[model samples]
Target: MNKWPVFCLALSAFLVPTAGAAGQDVQAGQILYDKWCAGCHGFDGAGDGYAADYMLPRPRDFTLGIYQIRTTSNGSLPTDEDLVHVIDKGMPGTAMPGWEAKFSSSQINDVAAYIKTFSPFFEREGAPDPLEFGRQPRREGIAEGREFFEQIECFKCHGDAGRGDGPSAPTLQDDLDFPIRAADLTENWNFNGGGSVEDIYRRLRTGMDGSPMPSFSDLIDAQFMTEEQLWHVAQYVHSLSPEEGPTISDVIVARRFEGDLPASPNDSLWNQAEAFYIPMVGQIIADERWFAPSVDGLWVSAAHNDEQLALLIVWHDPSESPDPKWLEWQQSVAASMFPLLDSVGVTPLPDRLTVQFPTSIPTGRDRPYFLMGDARNPVYLWQWSSQGDVVPEATATGLGNVQPRRGESRTLASSAVWHQGEWRLQFGRSLATPDSEAELQFATGELIPIAFYAWDGSNGEQGSQRAVSSWYGIHLEQPTPPSVYLSPVIAMALTVGLGLLVVWRAQRREEG
Candidate 1:
């Protein structure tokens, strides 16, 4: 697991020199912006272009100028270099594309100045000095940084391991009081602040606006540490990037809750349950991993009440669908106009996730293979499709016996929400399904064999091309109060003690 420094919301404000962008031509920038940016950002920069509505994170409404990412404090505007950097590299995991290849450095600098024109905030900017980054990264600095990380309690929100599953993760909120998740330090690609060492340092120094990541500048009063210590901590954070897959246990039992159950994927209550990440490697059947996957693994947690069972599955994706549905028409037009593009792939992707279980709980230790199952054994597959709004259950006797479920069943329902670059899918079903052989049932304590398959529509994964997993047992783990089992043990002990006493008396009497 990667260790992420707490999200930093840095000091109140700072000044930065225009430096390289000074005296750039705004008119030239406007022309470039119109050619490259107006299609999505709108001519007025209000983020209301024809393409903006279809964008996952709608194009930035520059008029508001409330940038989510910045080196400046919460309310301050980003520096010119900040804007130029974003344009040059492009924001990864978003619809934005880098202009560095298409435009010269001078053109990019001019466009950077033009982007500021949409918002008057930059006009009032007073010159501020760029933040001072002390010494270069060194091994000696890392040790000192570790001390600062612990001293400031960065472990509380980012977790001791920096996996972002800290004790306070579920309850973390932004300045707007909206529930916000801490950054999963391992997935460097999704870092909105950028992932370079300098980027990490800037994120730590400036902090993310509205997030729990507070800047340590003020916190680091000389008594606490020096400026170099802050840089060392940033380097330390960079080093903590997740090197391997998360720890996955062979057996995972569901935590049980009483009365009401969590309905949404983001519910804070779900955090109480034991989280086991089922990585693609752990779950994917060896013979079948045909294509390279866009994702490495998935996050999973399960909970059960008296009647309902909920499974929350989370995985990362760059696009919600295989490609933007909104752009399909345009893509077709371009393809038709250009015959040379005949070989260009236009995928028909159906994003979906499937869960498989033995049609009936397996007997003894024998269980079916994790795939669709063999002809000798059958499995029930409950499928959730991104295209379909409903949760339909299917039963497959083997790889070819895929059939729709018939008749009313005990339970099946699901809900999902997509946020940031991750999709949180929640599925619910009943503990028992009419006590029938055709349905898969769950008992309070007994283990049930379960397997998962996920399809990334955007990646053109379909049929067997999808990611698969080995079988993992799922069981409801009801909480046991200390005395529930303790009293029985105590009684048994006393009963054994009395019997021993009687035996000893008889032996003694006989000897006498």
Candidate 2:
């Protein structure tokens, strides 16, 4: 859909009054809601629609009368206009899509009023002040806010630089006791509270209920911070995007070193390498993907130290894989179809993280398909997965040619840790592992073609049901050689000596 029309509609919604508009029809709203909202939020407003269980942060239970995005103060009910705004804009990074273009103004107005009928809170609390946000401050205001952010221990959970990787980061959880992660402030686009400065300010004061995020309104009063100080922190937060460009890169040059390779995945040394953002598309062929991939972006980073190279991959998933219900459902369906296949028994389908490279980086050779390679050419796959009690490092040269790697215990080191709803996996091996034409060797300053693939077992991804990325380049950056420093001294000496030679040649020419 063309965004200009929707943008114009959203702008108009703010200027004019939407509440008590011509369309106050509850029946009309119900019709529209069923057509749109019922897929994720149940018709009864119980938050148990067909797709709701798979969603992260989950959908709001209207019966609870607690809305995350609201104009009313924290714990207070939202006015009619607040509901209309959310309907028009919708939630950005979730399953909720904006309805600006699909529905007319009357439909939106009608639905906003009708949804309130889901709970008794609307009738009992007849009136509440609809909050209004004003202009944001200049740089001075943001600086003052940064001060308050530190004084009140916001840095403990949000990080000192507001990157969301604070000391207390990995321990966060949701109201249901499920693991949850703090939002990375640098990526403001991921903020569920809305991206505008005003939206940030509102979230700062109101706070998200049922999550680790805390309400600063009470904490502010105790700290003796002025009212304006709150807005400043919001401004400071809004300004926190990485000072250059997106923090993610698709084409990355691995950080190279000469000495000691870092073995620990959590070592601070990994910070020297920048994370690359690998975007994945659904493996839609053959109905391979049973559902839309909840994961879209996978972060990668690499570093090499003479003997070995380490690559890290991380992604977020609300639920862990091998869920008993999902596993049983698939097994039952298989048993009904083919009793022979059922005899194989049921087991956990482990999540897969794979790194791919050209079998050999020779000239005039066509690399294989980003998948397991085409019929004509093959690719090298280094796969990491967990089995009954063993974490295996398997190597494959083609689609179905996987084999156990024969090498030292540390030849291909890999480990995975899931925490706070995110998966972190690190893989490393000898620079010359799988030491044959089947593997692409790592070398400094060499450009190598690489691809990536991921499988989420909880999403019913197995066999061909995986997310994959197109081919991209990886390079090991070359350091300046020590011999380069002597060039300046040689040039200076040559210039002086050549100057005298030229003068003598001129005198000899005059004599001739």
* Tens-digit per-residue lDDT, 202-221, candidate 2: 88777776678876777566
The residue-level lDDT of candidate 1 at 311 comes to 89
Candidates' RMSD to native? 21.4, 16.1
Each model's lDDT: 0.66, 0.65
Worst-scoring 10-residue span by lDDT in model 1 = 7-16
Question: Which 10 consecutive residues of model 2 have the lowest summed lDDT?
Answer: 494-503
TM-score of 1: 0.48
lDDT of 2: 0.65
Clashing residue pairs found in predicted model 2: none
User: What's the lDDT for candidate 1?
Assistant: 0.66
Write candidate 1's Cα lDDT for 1-512 as tens digits. 43343322222112222332487877788888898899889999987676664333447778766565666654567877777788888876456888899999889989888778788777777325556755565554767778777888887777666655455654565553434446666566657767666787777777765568877666555456766777888777777765553676544557788877788888988888777776552122333332344445677888998688888888865345644541342233223323355543365465688888888877554667556877778888888887883347888866546877756643788777765356788888887877477788787655677778787665445566566666666767656774564454344333323322332344356425
